[model samples]
Target: MPSTVFDIPTWVNPKVAPDRHVQIAKALYSVPGDLIGQRLSARVDAQTVKLYFRGELIKVHPRIAAGRRQTDPADLPSELTAYAMRDLNTLQRRAESHGTHIGIYTAAVLEHPLPWTKMRQVYRLLGLVRRHGADIVDDACRRSLDAEVVDVGVIDRMLARGATGQQLTLLPPPAPSRFVRSATDFAVRRPS
Candidate 1:
């Protein structure tokens, strides 16, 4: 009997449970994204594999050596990463294109030190434009800015309550101090 040779495919995208990420060998990889399932294809190279989504290359990883596990941070959405990796200027410009108040609020978000830290909030605000229309988001943003408070949570609540056009109340100014404390007040004194 003639011996038959079997060719084995080296690359694999093992199925994962719902709300879980795909596993490639010991490494976990992202399909289009973790939130939605999408068709993905992987091409094996001598030392790496390229992952594609909708014909667009999305991730690449080096072949896993025995007993080695590799994790690519880029595999996940930027928001899912440890810190939001985004361009503050770009996000601000996009918000500005919507409305002045939105622009101002966006500016505040970016101006805060380490803008990446606040990227999720900025992205949420941007997404609202598609959900509620620019007019409504702009109005909400305007109200938030005028209230002298910029917060996505507050804006989301207002939008949910159909208060986009409602006027926002300004916070009361800080109360006047009745007395000024001097540093000597805390000074230790020897017993008489």
Candidate 2:
């Protein structure tokens, strides 16, 4: 009978911050909030760490160099979504690069009174590009620009039916607001 010997590396237990994240060698790492206050282990690799909580492996990420931090959108706690949504600059740039109309539309949607609320709409519009391919989506967006349509529903319909380029009378745009509105405005005001 013959047996094979396997070498298993060891890990170290460590405490995490209230944000359920830790910094290793100047590189920040996200840990599930639920893991906070519990014994956790960090199995180090040259480029990543296998984070374990309750003896269960949770996250692995490429080692971050000094002065660098990484935050996964999925790691964001529910309560922090609004704060996270505040920065959609990357998505805006992506939408802008896709096409002029898409960029305009994405900007408008993100500018809505409650941009976070409208984020899903933006994602849906972007999903079209994924489904139809970037080139086709760009063509559709070009046609959308020609048709003077910026609404996602209209853009989607046009793409599905191949009517993007053909012009059709669009409804008069709603009166443009002179000022942008933030989520705070919708909060129920209490008379003091």
Quote the positional error of residue 112 for candidate 2 in Å: 1.7
True-vs-predicted CA distance for residue 58, candidate 2, Å:
10
Top-scoring candidate (lDDT): 2
- 46-129 per-residue lDDT for model 1 (tens digits): 567677665777777676654554555565565544432355666777789998888888888777767788888988988887
Model 2 residue 53 lDDT?
Answer: 77
**What's model 1's lDDT at 22?**
53
Q: What is the lDDT of residue 146 in candidate 2?
A: 73
lDDT of 1: 0.69
Report lDDT (Cα) of residue 52, candidate 2: 80
> lDDT by residue for model 2 over 128-190, one digit each (tens)?
987777677777666766776667787688777663466667899788576967678889989
TM-score of model number 1: 0.47
Candidate that would win on TM-score: 1
